[model samples]
Target: MDDTQTMHAMGIDDAYHVEQVLARGPRGVTELVTIDGVGPFVRKKIPTVLAQRGVWSALGGSTCPRLPRVEATYELPDCVAVVLDYIPGLTLEQAVAERGRLQQNEAVSLAQQICEAVQELHRLGILHRDLTPANIIVADDGAHIIDLGIARPFTNTANRNRDTTALGTYGFASPEQYGFAPTDVRSDIFSLGRILGFMLTGIYPDDASYATLLADDPNITPRLRAVVERASAFEPSARYQSVQQFAQALTAPSDPVDPVVPAPVSMLGASNGGIRTRAIIIAAIAGIVIVALVAAMTLIPRWVANGDAEGTAANGTSQNAGPQPNTSPDDNDDDMVPSPDSSTQDSEDDDATRGDAAYDNPLELVETGWSADESGLVHYAFGLRNTSDSVCIQFPSVEITGRSEDGSVLFSHTQALMVAFPGETTYFGSQAGNSNGTVPATVDFTILEPEDYNYVNSGESASFKVDNLNAAPDGYGGEIFSGDIFVTKDSERVREQSSQLNVSLVLRDDAGAIIYGYTTFVDWPPEGGSRPFSMDVFDPPAYDSFEVYAQPW
Candidate 1:
């Protein structure tokens, strides 16, 4: 559709003109439009039927300040177009890409804004099925959530019906969006957690990348990890029940008070205005808290308990202390636990030349390489192999020292430590500008000891079996493994409607050495039934065999 022609046809007020194209995508086109005597606005052509144009117009500016206000709606022949307040700013995605990662307090503060906006929408019975970073704009005023392409009203239960088509971004989408279940506020919470993780780590929250966060980052606090882990749990029941509750927890994890519920006022029978003011004051202070204490009670205990045991085993002299204050507020920290694959490695992958404890250190320097970017900035990358019996290994830091031709110090660069998986090599590097004309002749690189690591260990449970497993070559020289995990319901019937199920896949080389693998939490396979799963192992070695393990979380 011609934007200028469309606005001319509308004949809005005394004057109206198309300003510029804001964005164009699968949904439709968004343009900046200006109407004389009415100021500037944004117009979006929504192609999807479930778009919340009218709802947005009704709610308008009456709701949360972070939400865009709809000025008008037009039903075009080919699309439904809506005019909204033009929020000029960068998106959260753009901000992260430009700034690398957000500060801890900034992330939390922005998250609270997002939570408030989402909470208001939920209160009005609206569900924004797609709440990705691209849909959020970081304006000068605050973080504004935009795009309602797939938004559905609470009364429209058909929109909640299960479908095979995925409705959100791969890394941020909740499992239910992939037809596992219905989408709800919890799904948004899941995306919020993923966003929080990205803001903290500067990494997308994909299964593999997320494992790195759980495996290595010491800057991430235990409390924050607990919140993110539960929010992004495979099952909706495992996430924060509401955005408000999640916000409350983010605002104050130590507080026991519930932020969503309003305390009863002794002057409830007083004037309406007075009661409204009282409620506002309460809401302002109550802050936020979401979900039941059950998830925290269940997940945290196991994380702490298992992490304690694994820390002792991974670092013999490591202290297994209670959760401590985070050193880097922007980074996330969690206690590492021993995974199930750890045991399998010990029993099957032992080498004749090396004793069982040979892989205890698990830190092996792989290779270091450097390249220059378009701006002549030299980027240095170093790879490390984790030969640990455990599935995951952590590194505290990496330092590169350069010396001049005379053997004098030239420059030094230190990169933060990272997490790597068994059979998989992880890389960390830094970029430096060589404008000083002092290129070093000799350079020494060192891998420092990791602060802590949790061996992700799980035992073979009699309750579940991995069947119909198949491995094939991916087009990109990688291997793709697919299989089904089934639970054999017996005396240990999961009477509850919800349960935490964790699954892992391990591949071994010809010498029985671990090479590639993946671990993920999934919704409980149907009672006495199975759920399909798949994983792509990039640049894997020729495998002699593989192993799959499942356990109820």
Candidate 2:
């Protein structure tokens, strides 16, 4: 309808002038109107029949602070028009696009605010069946929830016999809403968690289906993940018992209760203002307490886990903390216990030429090129040539270690193949049966310092075995192994070529904290005309200093 026609139909005369259309939904349209009687107002147009059912009046008196204030409601010949205060802000969806994934702090803040709004609406016996990114607007001041056209009230008698159409966006709606059952505050909480998940990970959970999101990227804090999983439970009885409980779950830092599945909370006790009012007041206070707890829990974990490097750095207290004992490497060897195999003799023969096939002294070892099949699992080939004919070299079995970028150990395993020979090459790879146990391909091999290696026979070829190979995605975001392979002829020490190679490792546990790092260097035995080569591991936020280490090879 035209601006003049709508204004006249509502009996506002020339005093009300329509400016522009603001938003359009399934049940109604909202317009920005400038009235001479009132400066500016949002005019929402709904069907007269629907307004007569008292849905609009109930929603108009709701305590949801985020919803626009209703100024007036008038009936026209075929439709009903209600005037409301204009809310100015950008939608949450827009903010997400501009700022990739929000930090944990920002996400929790927004979620708590949304929960408070939901709690208020529920206290007033109203349900905002539609709660999605589009319905939530964010301003510099605060966030506002809008669009209550499909909102139903607890006291509506017609709602008892009404076959309301399923309402809500695909990804945001609770399962019960889709089943044509009564929606409660818990349903909104489920949508809130989905929104929080989207804010943390750039991807939305809805695009891939709720089942897929839960399986692949439940991108949230562990505690929050548990709550969201429960909120989105398929059964209604499995959901939060009340809006207060849902709000508590959203605002609570710890574990939360699941919703009811078989049947939602009955509305029998809702008429008594004393009981409902006390419940609402109690919920509000509980919400505040929970918000405080959530904030503390979210922020405290990060602070306590990060050590006191700040003060240490300021005091100039020797940047090198010295090598702390990493039980990780030794622990990884234990994980390499090979399964009983009938081809143990063949495996021994393969290791015979390489070296002594024992699991001791992994430092003296060498490996050839690595390869991976179509399945993306890697295999390393080691060629150990024994220079001494008199001494029978005993090769040690290989072991793989997994660590995060921050030096936190995740997994370690041992390979069964052993080598026993003066000079030979052997092949080793992730165990065939252990394919399903593969970690993310992005881990790193921790290169031992120069002191860690033992030189033999005039340093002809000092062997340095990598006892652990951490897997990684592309070997990025962590340490890459590179070191020198030096040889000496006499005490005069005529330096030969310096060998340097890069080895990539994977990182697991995206949420784990990083602790230590080191790097390797090339261009050994520097001459007057030779260029300098170097590598260093650095701490993040500010990677000013890094530990320098020498390789065994």
Candidate 3:
């Protein structure tokens, strides 16, 4: 393996017949090199002492299955070159970005695997000081931990609380790595939690775009969200003590346990103990009530059968004429009749309650604008607001009809937005198609409800105002429009629900004739914050003017 093969087949210092350059760093270079017997392998050159120690420990000692295998290492004049097994797969970061947010179950399973690997490393007295998403690779076999460049021995001694260097990625790194505390197992646990957040939100922990953590992300479940929040707590003492513990809690059953109900006395055994005593007491009380009722029944009829002191019967008739008795309470019905005023008031209250329960058209089109690029494509963007306090409506589909100057239909396009939310103003942008004329004369917008759309019951209401709206044309015949949605929080508590925003934009001619119509959208906006939005249209050169509208159904 040490024999000189070629000088320059692929480039830099052709000593090892390099197939391709994988990566290059300030201190070292990674390349795909071939051997006579071994088909292909990834070779990394470590020009620094710290990295060399990591490669040496991995090659000679670490037994963690998740860690990459170091096949061989050779000392260079000023560096050490290590040959490693090249696992074929995208990095975990790449996987998350490509797949968007992973399902909760999938993220949990993946986190468990990572925990197992890191736990093994800690058991072997190694601390992977830099454990970021880029250091993990997802392949057919399983997730593999890579890039142990900063790994070092972790001693449990009291004096191990201090370190000379502050090393690790922001957001993923623990406070200890910020020179605030000691770097230890707990530090890795913090990074793992951040990684879990990334997998569940498709957003890195430190990115400004993910300012709220998982607050607005609908893909994450509340149970998982709580787990992440606790694990990523700023204080190390507040986090899970170890990787194993964190994994256990992550995979633990989240649903609350149901309380046990007491068995009925009838189902108890005939032991003649407490059960027998309770039964006898209940029977005695029932017997006394029965005797009293019987005594009253025996006396009531006799009293009624006899005439009163005035010689009047119980039926309010003269006893001398006839001993008439009332047979039922309905004999005097006038006192039971309802008053007109009270009845009318009750009816009005019912009508008001029904009206409150009814669903209103909560979708509102705030505004619309257009832009065009040099390529002749026209872009349209619009704003929409959800007016209903409780209902979180989503637009499953939409239809737009473009008409000519004479009001005759020219073209139409149907699009699925899959957008939803309540109270926040959502911005939607889309490109219009090439037009036969400058623009369609008039346009119509239609919104379709999603299959699983349901209105939720909420006590609070949300309101938003669109401002700072502007539009411009791009060089590619596309338009760019931007605006800020200022949301004011409701005075009452708001119920959290998920929904998407769907929108339609129409270009109209001066004659009020149909011109062009299209659909577009942006997903749910934050609950109560100012969100700036921009839209681009690609299909170009249509109507003289445009109108924008939004709807959630």
> Could you say which candidate leads in lDDT?
1
Sort all candidates by TM-score, best to worst.
Answer: 1, 3, 2
lDDT of each: 0.52, 0.42, 0.51
Estimate TM-scores for all models.
0.45, 0.42, 0.43
Could you tell me which 10 consecutive residues in candidate 1 have the lowest summed lDDT? Answer: 287-296
Query: Which segments of model 3 are wrong by more than 4 Å?
Result: 1-15, 52-55, 209-213, 216-218, 254-553
Off by over 4 Å in 1: 1-9, 13-15, 48-50, 156-165, 207-209, 214-218, 255-553
Judge candidate 3 against the unseen true structure and give its global Cα lDDT, from 0 to 1. Answer: 0.51
Clashes of each: 22, 54, 37
lDDT of 3 by residue, 88-158 (tens): 88999889878898888888988988888898888777788777778899988778887776577775536
Off by over 4 Å in 2: 1-9, 37-39, 62-64, 155-163, 209-219, 256-553
Among all candidates shown, the one with the greatest TM-score: 1
Per-residue accuracy of model 2 over 1-553 as CA lDDT, tens digit each: 6777676665663357888876543245578898875657888776554453455676677656676777777766556788877777787878887886676678767877777777777776777766777778887767788667666776544533111233455456664443223566666766776777766665555343444444443355666666666666654466666656655776586645543344433221222111123332222221111111111111111111222434322211112212222222432222122223321433323321222132222232343222222222222222233323322322133344434346654434333221222333322222110122233233332322111111111222222233322221211122222333332211111121112211212111112212222122232333223223322111111122222222211
Clashes of 3: 37
Estimate the overall C-alpha local distance difference test score of candidate 2. Answer: 0.42
